[model samples]
Target: MARRLFLHVGTPKSGTTFLQSVWWANRDALLEQGLLLPGRGVNHHYWASCVVRGGRQVDTIPAAGLAAWDELLAEVSAHPGDALISHELFSPAPDERAEAALRRLEAVADEVHVVLTARDLVRQIPAEWQQRTKHGRSQTYDAFLDMIQKDEQARFWRVQDVPGVLRRWGQGIPPERVHLVVLPPPGGPRTFLWDRLCELTGIDGTGMAERATRSNESLGLVEVETLRRLAGTLQDDGMPKSTQRLLKDFVAEQVLRTAEPEKIVVPARAYPWVVERAQQMVAELDGQGYDVLGDLAGLVPGSEPIPGRDAADVTDAEVADAAVAALARFVRHEELQRRRGRRRPPESSLRSRVRHGLARRWTALRARAGRS
Candidate 1:
């Protein structure tokens, strides 16, 4: 049996979650079919990749996880058939770490391959902005636009990031070994991303059954403003880190049920250099025969260029719904705040609050002492 491994590195919001879900649900079946999807504690294969990519970013791969990685590789080496590991976070790693990890992977398996699914730039930018906002960012599309324009140094929106992403995982791997999956045209084909993976892996996607995928979408300036205003006013909507994550999946499923795309404006303050840089990158990649992931070559200029969308139709009803959502968020935030209040304040928090109160009381006490 050949020891081959397929690694799917995700560019977050590009359906990584769906693929993860697919592997998890079918783990037993896959193992029976002579395939492997490791789950020592959880099914976050990217954790191993992250460790392989070097640990500084998302908690130094815990010691247990580090040992687990070794065990995982051993399994891969001994397993009779093939295996799969995926985590899109791998897409952003610096080349050295990515290659270092791939090298480790290659040592364990006879063949190591890379897969990345991409959407167009026109949609990705705003989608990312919305993703940030959902997690408690208050940056307006306008401000985000400003950053995109002037923050050319920031790698998130740059075309440079795309090639950088590829160069990392593609190390010691042939171009053909790197498979690029373009999201099929909307409403065109079913499970296009999954089906493509099926084709790439020579597995039957249909047997796995199709389910909804998680995606990030950007809100329009107005819609974003609405959420921001609501966040400011609502005490509950604070979205503390812990609860926010758990809620995010639920919100993504229920609240954000598929909506239409929203239009956006890309002013000079937003992505000023993106147009030119992306075009340059596209040309550069095309010349190099590199398949530019997503629609970077097609990214538009100007504030009017709509970014990727999360949902659409911001009707009065939707706005009202969002308002209710804001209240729900506020309530959660307040609940957390109250819970925090009840806690023995971290000695630091207690001292700080008491010091300010004492300062105010001292003035009043001094006045009374003077009067006496």
Candidate 2:
């Protein structure tokens, strides 16, 4: 059995991707130091979480197979040292499912600790809207905010309600063992969050940040609006979820993120409501006995307004410009693939026959040269 198990449930859009990237990149080094990141790949934990939660599938992602949960548990049980399981998807699990997962986790380790990382709603709101776009949802930013505010069942609150998430996942675990790591406001050191994780887990994370290669890069306002439009069209055409996922991975992450358009930020009109909500969350978290690693005051947004145009305010001209740039990028990528011969040639084309003939002749020449 593992000695200690750290389950990092998440408040999404709070630097979870960067943390996971660093941990996965340094998994071998961490293993030598007695901290085990179980499973075969970076996304293994996410798939396992899906299985554990009754095969609940996230938008556009396929459901994990029934064996995923068992495989993850097997890895944890086999590890002799501390093990960590992390996924933002684990945050919003229903109460019974969350309890079931905790029960299984508790069976494999001497102690179970629930870790949550969170940032202010002022940032999370817009980020969550953009995330929905990536998942092929076409809901406008205004509609997303309205849903989250008015609907208790909004998916946003399920994951982003810091105090609520802790209460749900922290059940049955000792309050002191449940950890909340607050993400500091922007402009701090890049390694600050990693440092916090290391401090909590007692693992040496030196230089791990340099090794991390993945980031959940945010899209600019125009870029995201363009994606939202594309998503709506694809959904109308009944595009396969797998194909949508590919577009999100390639076009959104690779092409759209390179644009320099203005970023999405909370509208000035929403500041009062955002501030009030943040204060309420901080007040609730203050009373919770869970161990907090950073200042609770950091959860509250600042009085000064954040600068950036609302996503809804993005102009048609801006979206057109982004779309044209993305199209050009796709063309360039296709040309590069053809040049590198990564793309298959048409089977009936003269070019294909010539290429095959050249390949056979080259082989014959190599054979003769070797004999000589």
Candidate 3:
């Protein structure tokens, strides 16, 4: 068993994707420094997802996926050194589920530490809504806020409920062993989170800035509203869920992602409620006495809100521009495919030339024999 295990469970949208990307990109360097980062690259999310969404049979999960938990433990155990595992999905796990996951890790770890990265709800709320939209949700930003208010068990509350996430994952672990990484507010030093992560994991954070190959890009107000409008049209046509997903992927990858758009932020009207909720969560975490790696003040909501039009107020004219962009992308993709088709085939093989030579020789020989 490893001497220590650091589990970076998450409060999603707290720069988890960027962190994961960096870890994966520098995996080789980390291994050289004696830390085992198991699984495919920097993400062992499928394994963590299987554990959190526990059930006898969940078709969405890959077959034999549950074995990933054991496999991860085995990797850590085989290495007589410290190891790290990360997955943001593990944050929203219910108490019982979180306990089970913890016990499993504890069985193979001499010491276990739970790491939770958090951000203020003011930022998290709109980010969560945008994430839901990216996943094919058709709700407008205003309707999404209403759903959060009305539904106690809504997904927004499930993962973003900071105190609840900490409680479930931090259950029996020593308060000091639980590390709360407070993400610096937007516009703070970009390297702040990376530096703190290195401090917590005892790994080098340098030479890794160039290795981040994955990033979760946020959609702009117009881009998202346009997609939502497209979704509505699909719904009216009774488009299948599978088709809707493909359409969303196409627009997101082919159209929306071509250029970084101005990000959507929590509206001015919603700012006060968001601040209050964040303060409540901050108070809860403060009482727990966890080892906070960054400034607790980072958890406080920022004062300035970035300007964005509400999704519900998006006009057809605004969507038309996005539609034109999507059409251009389609044309470009088609031209690329045509160019690929027009490329010449490679030269014929030596064996084919030999066969042709032999055939010609045989034909000449037969003709000569007949003449003789």
Candidate 4:
């Protein structure tokens, strides 16, 4: 029997992070069951990055990232049982890169299955906009949607265009080997997707649900608008991109993540168009006859109203309140650090203080002797 490789390329925000976290956390158990999940962390994202940027002179492509694929393959080849490589970034590969990636995988494994986790565009669109904001993008929701419509944001469509993503990744591979896992709609079973993924891979993640500590949380209208304003200020002041990343991370952990947030929704006016596009994609997928693990109807956008303040409805006052709250949190964190610092003064500083006091006492004694 030839070694089997299961690839879970993703449409982001479809619980990929949680899935990867579960797999990484339960690595020992998975290995005991004859499955290999090889990576320093949850997934080999760097390898996917390299594959997408193949031979391009991009500064983000590091030597280690480029070599990650080879290192992962070596580990897979050494292990006799099934191997799983997952990275959502891999789903965005253009035709050329996707073909090349598959060719490389075929050389080492006799059977390679392509997996794609999908959700309706109506839900995905707003989430994608929020994701960009977290990454330092300051575009308004209106502009974000417009940019996607115009295909101005290459990365957005690369990961989003479901049928296109499948076509590229599933090229030269049988439709039977191409698996589509449609995410359950809102209010559906939370564990449905995980259960389906496990069934497909023959990996048991029965007790892994409790291990999800990290997730990409969505932002409320006011919170996201406030962050956008901050990003704009940073840009206007010529803040370095690296500094922006630091600031974003600090706020994400210290302020935004601590607060309860509302989900962004597709405006009612835009609903029909979004649903129409999603249906078209679903039709395409059905026509292709790929093996779908979940209900195809799940791909249709739900009519339930998403409860939250619309992006357009966010008021300047609300944004100001959010900004002030963020500043207060930051100040409180700084004050706590200051208190901790005073309680634990460095040894060098303590020694310096002692030397200064002794010197002052000796000088006073000498002056008194001169006066006598």
Candidate 5:
């Protein structure tokens, strides 16, 4: 059995992606130091968490399916040293499920520790909205905020309610074994969070920072608003979830990402409530007696006056400008794909032929206009 198991359940939008990227990139080094990251791939923990949460649907289960948790347990039991399992999706499991999952981990290791990395709600709220938009959700920012603030049963609260998540997952584990690694406020050193994780997990993360590759990119107000509107249109047109997911990735990563980012901030009307909630969370976390790695007070929203346009208040003119910019990027990307021989073969259908012909003509017109 593993000597120690660190389970990093998360409060989403709290640097989870960056930490996971660093760990995966340095897996070899970690293993050399006797820290085993069990399972076959980067998403191994994700699938295992789904199984523990009782998710058996085709969409939720991975390729190896519902047996992922058992596979992970077997790997941990066979390993001789420390192991870490991480996934933000694991943070929201209810009390019974959370306890059961912990018991399973305890069975495979001599010691089990629950690690939660958290950030202030002031930053998390808008970030969560943008993340949902990336996942093809069409809810307006106003409605999203309203639901998070008023609906305790809202899915957002399940993963993001810091104290609540701790209460559920920390039960029965020694307070010292359950860690609350507070995410430093923005504008500090980029490696601060990684350093904190290393301190808790007893792994030397030297040179691991540069190996980190993936980040859940934050979208600008115009970009996110455009995606939000597109999501609504696609949903209304009965687009398949799979196809919509592909389109969402294309638009968010390829097209709209080229535009200047306009940071999303809490609107004045909602700022007070956000601050109040942050204070409540900080108070609760402080009282929980979980081992804290950084300042718990950092979880409170900072009072600095930030300047930016609210996503809920984007104008039609801004949307139009963003749409045109994104269209130009899309055309250039398609042309590049064609040049690289990556474009799909032409379809035989008349509609496909007509569309291709129109595209060729548009390219010809643009070339002529450039020459003139």
Candidate 6:
């Protein structure tokens, strides 16, 4: 039992990956300062666990190899220092799940604080759909926008329904215990998402480290089209789960290490509409009166902030060029990573054998090819 169990419940796409990276990078330093971030297998097995719980058929991992969710909870309770669990999908849990999380946290924690970091959904949804595109989702930006705003069949909630998400999770947990870190601002120090997160998470400003686990998604329209086309081929070829996992795992930690996870996606450009809608939703949330942070900005009815338009209005020719350049960069980065990985790791005998086998004949073969 720790003095505080700070559950970083996410409202997603609000720099959750960067926050997790910071915490993991400084885990040893944080431990010295009485902060403990525990996961199932020494790593925050949170995503794997979440995939087990809510991921679609494609996300389905091996059930037999999957560790029970309750066992994961026990590990969280056993850890010393101020406990912290971060997984963005935990936003508004199902009634039973939320109740279970709260009960377990209450029994083990001296006190509990729900830390929610949110960006204006006006900006978040389109970026999210761009992400969905990166992950092989074929839904168009307009279609995804419709679902985020109005479709109930998908079980998507209004992004402005922040308090509702809390209400679901905070049933037994007290209202006072919840904290919110809002992105952007009503005024003063237009907060970049990272700085605000650092302020709230207690990570020292001077000690920033390289992020771990590169972003799971990033794509401009053409790259998205490429992936969408790939997904269609996947359906035809019956791509195996194991094959997808191997590629994604490497891509996450390696290929994306240098990739611009955020591209100027059209879906991102259309986000202002989502902002307007979210403003109405936030107004309703504000009336309910809960722990609040971050202004909904232009989304609020009377308080609509002028949209700071980025280069989204660029012509199709410009967009096509940008997309082409982005694809080149992504492919180049992946190629470099492949070369580096092959050159490195001779630790295992199998790797040594593979390395020697490549080294022994590859130069001669390359020389022959060059002559030809």
TM-score winner between candidates 2 and 3:
2
lDDT of 1: 0.58
Tens-place lDDT digits, model 3, residues 28-63: 889898788877654355565656657642454556
TM-score of 1: 0.69
lDDT string for model 1 (1-372, tens) is 237798878666666777777777777876877778765633346567656656464464545665656667777887868888777766767667777778888888888888777654545676676666555555656667667666756656422245556667788797767766666434546666777777777776667844433334544444554444333332243444543343344333333333552454343333545566656655545554444334443433334544443333234344544445544554575478688886544534322332333233334434554665
Candidates in order: C-alpha RMSD to true structure: 9.7, 11.3, 15.1, 12.0, 5.3, 8.5
lDDT score, candidate 6: 0.54
**Candidate 4's residue-wise lDDT over 1-372, tens digit each?**
228888888989888888887788788888888878866765355565555546552345556666677777777777788888888888867688788888877776778889999888888999888777866678999988777766734678788878888999998998999999998877889899889988988877888878866666676777777677666655554545454555456665566554667668887766777787778888887779798988887778876545555698876556656665665676686689788885634644322332332234335434554565
Can you write out model 5's per-residue Cα lDDT over 1-372, one digit (the tens) per residue? 999999999988888889889899888899999999988766788888887777443365547856778988999999999999998988878789999999989899999999998888878888999888887788999999989889989988898888899889988899999998888888877788999999888888888989988877888987788777766655554545564456546667777785458888888778888888889888777767789988889888866536767675776556656666767886897799889998566743432332333244345445554665
> Better model by lDDT, 4 or 6?
4
TM-scores vs. true structure, each candidate: 0.69, 0.89, 0.85, 0.85, 0.89, 0.70
Query: In model 6, where is the ten-residue run with the lowest total lDDT?
Result: 350-359
TM-score-superior candidate, 4 or 6: 4
> Which lDDT tens digits does candidate 2 get at residues 125-155?
9899998888778899888887877887887
Residue lDDT tens for model 6, 1-372:
666787776776766777777677776776777777665332344553353335462156456324544555566567665767777767746667677767777777788878777766545655576555444455655677667656643434622356566777677777667766666643546335556555555655455445444444544444444333333434443444543443234322232333443344334445566555666666665544445555544333223433432333433343334334434554676578688875643455432332232233334434554665
lDDT of 4 at 91: 80
Residue pairs in candidate 2 whose N, alpha carbon or C atoms collide under 3 angstroms: none
Model 4 residue 20 lDDT score: 83
Candidate 3 minimal-lDDT segment of 10 residues: 350-359
**Candidate 2 off by > 4 Å:** 55-64, 345-372
**Candidate 6 root-mean-square deviation in Å:** 8.5
Q: Tell how far residue 41 is off in model 1, in angstroms.
A: 7.4
